[model samples]
Target: MSFISVNPESDFSIHNLPYGIFSTQANPKPRPGVAIGDYILDLSQVSKLFVGPLMRNEAEEVFNQTTLNKLMSLSYEAWHEARQTIQRLLSKHEGVLRDNSELRSTAFVLQRDATMHLPAQIGDYTDFFSSLEHAINGVKLFVDGDKALFPNWKYSPLGYHGRASSIVVSGSPIRRPNGQMRPIDDRPPVFGPCKLMDFEIEMAFFIGNTPNKNGDIVPIDEAHKHIFGMVLMNDWSARDIQKWEWIPLGPFLSKNLGTTISPWVVTMEALEPFKVVNVVQEPKPFPYLYHADNYNFNVNIAAAIKPDNGEASVVARTNLSHLYWTMKQMLAHHTITGCNLNAGDLMATGTISGPTPDSYGSMLELSWNGTKPLTLSDGSERKFLHDGDEVIFTAHSERDGCRVGFGECRGKLIPALAL
Candidate 1:
């Protein structure tokens, strides 16, 4: 409905004006931009268009920054007002931007000519095991038959602190990590390149400018205000190394090697219409982690693998609704002990899996720990990722011909350095 010529099937529709940091060849300085159709609406050039009460004077300064941290630190009301002002300015009926020839030339840049960077400087990252099916699969594959699920898993959301410095924007090359692994049961661990490299399909949210005091907990009802938006993530795993090291302690080098994330961050307001019922929790969590409103989004998440010379083929598909714990619950539980959260912090839903084999989220679950291999269109079989394999993660929700999507989170695995 806008003045732009957006294809109906394009993910960057007027309804989904996702934000990211980008730069062009002429001006190499990174700046904030909003994706629309095939072009990026340069916020730096059109900052004055945000004339809403909340963003009137602040927009020009915030949009000029190289990173999104300052903008994300604003109040939730200010964020909402920014979106409203943008939607109005881009509307077909609005002559302010639609008819301004000089402004249009400066305010819009073709997406293909732009280079993307990380939206914010993430201070910390947390990865949560919130999917019931993925957890059950792990228990079945690795634990004794008597313990179907970990006792603490049902009581609360389980998570681990992740390395923020290693997290990279999509399309970055992932170097296979070298670490010690006990390949044989009784043999001493050997140090070498990872043999079982894998990918984990996930989605993460960036914390807003709102920060809690060190000794105060963010209530479940108020967690939404602290969340800014979501992005697709690929938590690359070194399975053999992880199994050897993760015992009393959780993931370390096996997880920190490199995590890939999509460039654009799809805001909560754009995805509001896709909210669906959450997975039912059996024992029911504590009162502090409960919320009457539905926070689970009905996003269709899928993973595909492409060999260096072959076509991409989808291997797994799942929905965000399958996650047993909501983002609100995760945030509430995270700060229950009075741990603080900052504006650019990230929290991810780990390996979202559903009830079927094809819905599994990671290579460990999809191939049943290498017992069953997946055959691709080129007749190549994969139990784990190869040196030239590229893993791609995508997520989107569509209704009534309208789609809100996080574009591809992609990474190509390369050989590790010689030990």
Candidate 2:
């Protein structure tokens, strides 16, 4: 496909074809749009003014909805159909959308003036510690490298239920949370603002196609059938709070603050060409849990931190392939307990740090349990995220000679006010 005008740097390039909800800042009503040439082609507006024969014939109801959820709930074939339709409409060919001047006036909106909104109405969220390297590193920091991995990790995907209500759109600032922490020297837990705020470098899988019948819980092998797409995710954390509260039941106050997701949802169909085996196992998965392609995609992920006022500092570079458990494994494990998943639900890959000091995903690990500090390029030191720290996560796949990038997932930190 010929590259369209939305500069290559723009997240919505032809290779990207990411979907999101948008509207002009003046009107901010939250409607569907496709990024094209420094502009957002408003699907809602295009649905009304578009006189194109093919699009008019096949434009599904998803385009009419305010968010991408309607489109996402459709089947993979349906998604492909919509993508093809949108691509053609966006093409620079003479007989394409440009054929109608009035249509262009109504459909095209500048991206800068556009207000980006949540891509979907997330119903529920589940976080999984799917990265072996990350889990080992975390263990090594608290325990040691020899027993870096714990029980129930090598066997299946270890995960925890997360808060959906707290998830936020990109650019929204996160607040430093009030949490309970313990002092080292024979002191009881004290209440104060979290001192070790951090961001988890990860990716999120979006669920779609809810099972309708009595046997509604989807099997592991068929999990992909119900998924919509993937997004770059930053699962923010408060290490100080987690340490105090996490004696028995996992994360609570530390995780509930705010999680951020990239504005665009990269469709599952776009990634179909590059599916590989999830894990190399001698003991294959059980029959019911196994389908066909049980492999993971080679999606490259990275994290960066920038002061609210200054340039970004590169943090970690990792990939989904490094994950011990794949999305399929996580889904299989989720439904192994017969849990029913709904449309718009999210399954996240937990903290994705690699095995090294420089590859640490969070400051807690890089600082070695707060023993050291990270020296930034600007000569600043960071033991933990401060009041004005901003973190960004980006995920992309370079396959078939195409670099498909999912726009940055970002959040700013604001200090907690005394209550």
Which candidate number would show the highest TM-score if scored against the true structure? 1
User: lDDT (0-100) at residue 346 of candidate 1?
Assistant: 95
- Residue-level lDDT tens digits of model 2 in 342-373: 67888998987766667766777777777788
CA lDDT of each prediction against the hidden true structure: 0.93, 0.76
Clashing pairs in 1: 73-209
Worst 10 residues of 2 by lDDT: 49-58
Instruction: Write down the TM-score for model 1.
Output: 0.99
lDDT of candidate 2 at residue 5, scale 0 to 100: 59
Per-candidate TM equals 0.99, 0.91
Candidate 2: the clashing residue pairs are: 5-37, 6-37, 6-38, 276-295, 277-295, 278-295
- Can you write out model 1's per-residue Cα lDDT over 272-337, one digit (the tens) per residue? 999998788888889999888899999999899999988998999999889999999999999999
